[model samples]
Target: MAGCGANVTLDPVTIPTPLIDPMPMSVAVRIPAEFEDYVHEDEVLGREKWRIDLGRSNAALFSQLFNFMFDEVTILGPDDDASTLAIDALIEPSIDAFEFSVPSQSRTESYAVWIRYRLKVYDSAGDMYANWPLSAYGKSEKFGLTGDEPLKRAAILAMRDAAALMIMNLDKSTAISALKDRPAIAVASAQPAADEPAPREKRSQLPKRREVALPPPGPAAGPAVLSMDPDSDATRERVPEGSSND
Candidate 1:
C-alpha cells in the first residue's frame, strides 16, 4: 500500500463462434453472485498495489460460450433454482484462483495473467457427474507508459484462452454430450403403475452418476501455452501422444 496503485476494470468479453457442431443437449448454467462481480487485489514486491475488477465479465463470457456450444441453453441467476427446470444437465462455473505479474516483478516487458476456472456438471437428479478444473494464461507486452492497458488486454486474452479450451475439450473431458435427451428418458422409465411394483431391471437402466475425484487442494502447474485457436497446430502439439487416463 506504500507505492503507486492501479485499478483496472474489464469490459464484458465476447468469443468468436466456434466452427463446430453444437451438442444436441439442452443445458442450464448457474452463474453465482461472486462470479458476476469478481475482484482481485494484490501487492507486487511491496511496491505496487493492483486492483482488478471483472464485473459481470465472467458471467457474460460463459453465457455466450455455452450458447454456442449447446443446442439450447438457459441462463440462471444466483437466486434461481434449477430443479424446476427441465434440462439434460446443469453446469456451474466458478473461479478457483487468479494471478498476474507485472513487468517490474518479472523483469520483462510483458504483463501476464493466470486464471484457474472450475466447472461442475450435474445430471437431472442433481447428482454431480463431472468436475473439471482448467488453467488459462495470457501475456501482453507493455504498450504505453502505464500498465493498465496491457493488464486489461492480458486478462481479456486469458478469458479467450479459457473459451478456446472449453470449446475444444469440454465434451471430451466431461462427456456432457452423452446427457442429451437423457432426462426425458429417465423420467419415463422411473415411474411405474400405482398397483404394480417396478421391475428390478428398470432401476438398472438409469444412468449412474459417479463421483469425480478432484486433485488435492494446492497450486496447480503453471498455465499451459496460450492459443486462441483450439484447432491450431500449437494447441494440438500440447496434446499428449497417448490417450489420457483422465
Candidate 2:
C-alpha cells in the first residue's frame, strides 16, 4: 500500500449519565396563643400537653421529609437562623374545624385552624424557581375525654397531612427535573466565606405572585318547579313573584 496524507476520523464518545440530585425542603412554624382554643381541659396540664405545640410539632414532622440533608433544617424563632429550605408560615383566625368523627357516631364538631405556608425551593444557583403555597384546616375536638392530648394529637396529625400533601408534589418536581439533561456549560462555583454562615435571604422573603381567579360558578338552575302544588293543583305557578310553585 502506498502511503498517503490521509486523516483518520474520530467518532464522538458517549458521556456517562449524570447523578440525580436529592430533594430539598424546609419547614417553618407559626405558633400563637390561639392554639389553646383547640385544647381540652385535660390537655391544659401535665407534661403530655406541653409537648403539643401544634405549629412546632407539625414543623418537626415536616422537617423529617428533608432530614436526609444534614444541617439543612432551620428552626426559626421570632428571630432565629433562616433555613436552607426556606418555608414560611402565618397563623390565621380560627375557623369551623372538624375533629375526627366519633368512632360510633358519624357526626362530630371540632375546632379547626387555618395555616398558610409558603415554600420556596431553589436550584444549585440559589435561585428559587419552584414556589408553593399550602393552606389547610386543622381540626381538634372542642371537648373530649383525652382532654388536651386529643387536641395536641389532632394538630400534629393535621399538620403532617398538610405537609405530606405539599411534599408529594414537590418530590415530583425534583424527579422530573432530574431526568432532564444538564446544561452544556459549567457555571461558576460560588464558595462562601470561611467564617460566614450560609446565605438565607431568598427563603426568608416571599416573591410577589400574580393573582389567579377561580373559574366562575356554573349557571344557576331555574327555581326548582314543583311537579304538583300543595293544594293538589297540577298547574305550575311562579311563587310570590321571586319564588316558583307548581
Candidate 3:
C-alpha cells in the first residue's frame, strides 16, 4: 500500500497601491454618532478598543481618498453656494446614512463603505448622491512582511477601487443611454391600414403529406429460356430407352 498527500501553503498577500489620480478633493465625512468617543483611545477600553480602531480606520480611509482626489481635481463644496454657504463653516455631523460591512481575514480584511452624500453642482440644486458601495475581501500567507503593513496596504487598495467606482457612477457621459439628449427610440403605435393587406407569399404547401402508395411492383423480368436439339450429332446422347448400342 502507498500513501500520497499534498502540503498546502497559502502565499502571503501583498497589497499594492491603487492606480488613480493623486489630486486632492474637498470632501467631508459623516461618521456615526456612536463612533464619537470611540475615536478617543483613553475613552475606549477593553473590547471597545476594537470598535475605536475600526472607526479610526474608516476616518483614515476617507481622508486619504479625499486628498488623492484633491491633488488631481478641484472638489466643489457646499460653501460654493452663496445662499447656503458659510465662509468658516464646518462639515456637519450627519448620520451614517449608508450601510456597509467589514469582514476581516487573518492577512486581509474586506472593507465596504457607502455614503449618502449630497453633491451640489453649478446652478443646479443637488440631489442625494449615494456614492457606489464598495467591497474587497481576500487573504495572504506571505512571509517576511512587516506587522500591519499588509493590512494597511490592502485597505488602501480597496479604497482606491471604491473611489474609481464612485467617479464612474457619477459620470454621465459613460451612461449614453441615460443621457438627456439621447432618449429611447420611439416605437410606432398606430395600427396598419386595413386596405393594404399583408403580402401573401406563395408557399408550396408541403406536398400534401399523404401516404404515397407505390404502384404494385411490376412483374420481374422472366428468366431467359434456352433450347437444345437432343438428336444433333454434335450433341452426344445417353443410350436410348432399352436399346444398348454396342
Candidate 4:
C-alpha cells in the first residue's frame, strides 16, 4: 500500500518453543543494524511493484530463537563490543539474499518466498571457526487471503522455516556446541630460549590444523522445504523438478 506498489510490513515473528535440550554453551549474538531493518523491493513481471519491510522482526526472531536454543544467550547491539565478555563463541547472522514470487510471476495461486542466511561463528579467541549458509523456502496459496496477506504469510513461514533449520542443524553444521568452555589459543613467546637452537626453515610445511567439512543436510522437496545446501546459489529458489513453477 505504498504509492501504487504492494507494500507489506511484517510484524515481529514468533516460533514455537522447541522441545529439544539446549546447547550447554554461553554465546553472544550481535545483531547488525542493517539486519534489523532489512527491506526488499522488486517488480514482478515488469508490472507490479512490491516492497517488503522486515523492520525489527529479524532481530526479535533471533533473540527469541537463540534463547530457546542455548543455555545462556547474550544479545548485543551493533556498537557493543564482545571481546571483554566471557563467552564460548560469538555468532553473527545475516541475510545473504531474499526473493519472492507472486501469483502473476509463477502463474499459480501461491506466493513463494526464499531466504538465504549466513552464519559466522568465532571462537573465544575471536578467530573464525565456522561459516555456514542455509536456505529456507515457504509457499502460501491464495485461498482466502487478499491484499498482500499471502505474501506476508509466506515470508513469515519462510522465517519459521529458517528457525526450524537452525534448531536442527546449527550444532551439526557449525559444531558450535564444541566451543563450550573452550580456551583461547595462547600467544607464543616472543623470543626462544638461548639454550634452544634456532628453528630450521623448511621448504614446505604442513598445516598445523585442518577442518573437516560436514556434508550438507539431506535433500527435501516441497513447497515449504527447508534446505541447508551449501552449494545452492542465491539466484533463485530451487523448486523441485517438474513442479508447476519450474
Candidate 5:
C-alpha cells in the first residue's frame, strides 16, 4: 500500500530486508501481472476507500519471501527489462480474492480484509510446473481511526501473516526442489515457452463422505415412569378441587 490512509495512519508492515545468502541458485520472483478490479478498490467505505492497491502490496511482500527462499532472489518486476535476472526457477503470483468489510455495521469500528492468490512456479525452461493457493487477512480496531485506517491495517497484517505462513508451510510444495536447480540464461522476459508443462496428476475431486446405513428400527422402548418425591408435609399444602378444607 503506498498510503493506506490520507490522514489516519496504520502502522503497516515494512518490507523485509534480510541478510541475503550466497547459495548455489539464483531465483526470480515475478510480480503479479495484473490484479482483479477489487484489489484496487473497495466500494463500501468513507474517504480513501478506493486507495489501497492490494496487488502491489502482495508483490512487495512476496518478493521479500523470495529473498529467503533462494541464495539470491532477483525480483523479475513487471517491466520489460528482465534479462539480467538469469534465474534457475521462477515464481509467478496472481490475486484470486481481495475483499474488505466491516465485521458489523453497529458494533466495531474496525474492518477486516483478506487477499487470496494462486501461485505458479516455472522452471528455467519456462514451463509452469506447479501451482497453489494462499490467503491472508488483516484487521483494524484502534480508536478514532479513519480515512482508510482499517484497510491499511488489513493489508499490512495480511502480508505479514502470509509471509510467515509461507516460511513454515511452503516446504510441502513440490516446486521447491525444481526451483533450486537447472539454471537458465536471462532473457528480456521470462515468457512462457512453447513446450508447456506436463499435465499434473490431480487426485479425484470427489468428497470422501460415506453414507452409513442405520439398523432398522426395532420396537420402541416403553416410556419410563417418573417417581416424584411426596413428603407427608408437602402433600398437605395442595387443596383438591371441590374438596378443599376451608
Candidate 6:
C-alpha cells in the first residue's frame, strides 16, 4: 500500500489478418478461473504500484483479436452472456508473465508480456473432446524517459504481437485441424504441443470377426516309410534321394 499511486492502463490491440483461413466454428474467448484472484503488481525504483487492474484489458484485447481472426465467435465476459450462443468450443487465455524495465544503465526501458491459452472442444456428450495450448509474447522498448505512457504502449504492443503469433501458428497447428476434422474424439486433454500432437493412443475400428470353416483338416497325415536300405546292414537316416544332406 506504500507506493506511487498511478493508473497503468491499456487500449485495444489491432487484430491482424490471419495468415491462413480461419477455421469455421463458434469459439468463445475467456479468462481462466485461476486468474480470477490475480492482481498486477508493479515495482519501480523502490516505489510500488499496487493492484494494477489488467484483467479487463487482457480479456477485451483477446476477444477482439480472436473475433477478427475467426468466423462465428463470441468475446465472452463476466456479465454472463455466453449462455445465449451455441458455441462449438471455448478458448481461455492466461497471462504467464508481465515484466518491465525502467530506464536504467543496464538497459533501456522496455516491457514484455507472455500469454498462454487453451482451446477446448467438446463432443456430443458434452464432454471435452480436445484441448490444446498456445502461447506467445510481445515486447517494446523506449530509449527516452517517458511517464506511464510508454509502458501502456508497450503492453498494447505485446498483446498485439501475441495475437499475430496466434494467427501465424493457427495454420500450422495440428490440434486446431483435428478439432475441425472430427471433433468427436473424447480423450484426455493434452499439454502444449510443438505444432504437432504428442505420442498418443491410436484409435481404429476393431477388425471384424469372420466365421469361416477350416479347410477339412487338410489330408490325413501319412506314416513315414524308410526307403533305400534294403542292401545295407545299418539303416542310418538315408537322405531322401533328391534332398541334399550336408
Off by over 4 Å in 2: 1-52, 68-108, 142-146, 172-246
Clashing residue pairs in all predictions, respectively, total 0, 2, 13, 1, 0, 0
| Model 4, runs deviating above 4 Å | 1-4, 184-246
Model 2 residue 22 lDDT score? 37
Quantify all predictions' global Cα lDDT against the true fold. Answer: 0.67, 0.30, 0.25, 0.68, 0.47, 0.45
1-246 in candidate 6: lDDT tens per residue? 465535775543444344345568666655454443344665554564523455556655666566655686655433333444465555555655444444431254554343454454443234455555554444445545366665565455545555555555543542444554344565445653567653333212111111111110011112211211121212112222321111
Q: Put the candidates in lDDT order, highest first.
A: 4, 1, 5, 6, 2, 3
Query: Judged by lDDT, which candidate is best?
Result: 4
Give candidate 2's whole-model lDDT. Answer: 0.30
Candidate 6 ranges with C-alpha deviation above 4 Å: 1-6, 31-39, 48-51, 78-85, 104-107, 115-126, 129-135, 171-174, 181-183, 186-246
lDDT of 1 by residue, 29-116 (tens): 8777788788998877777888899747777888888888888888877666667666898888889888787777777787767787
Instruction: Identify the runs in model 5 with alpha carbons over 4 angstroms from their true place.
Output: 1-12, 15-24, 35-39, 45-49, 79-86, 103-106, 182-246
- Give per-residue lDDT, candidate 3, residue 197: 38
Model 5 over residues 1-246: C-alpha lDDT tens digits? Answer: 232333322332443433333346675665645731123544333323344555444554565566665676666544433344466666667777655555333245655555666666666666555666766555556566655565576556655555644544454654355456564332212233568644433212101111111110011112311111111111111111221011
Cα RMSD (angstroms) for every candidate in the order listed: 11.9, 26.8, 39.9, 12.2, 23.5, 29.4
Give stretches of model 1 more than 4 Å off. 144-147, 183-246
* All candidates: TM-score: 0.74, 0.36, 0.30, 0.75, 0.58, 0.58
lDDT of 3 at 85: 25
**lDDT for model 5:** 0.47
Residue 113 error, candidate 6, Å: 3.8
By summed lDDT, the worst window of 10 consecutive residues in model 5 runs over: 211-220
Error of 3 at 233 (Å): 99
Candidate 6: residue pairs that collide: none
lDDT of 4: 0.68
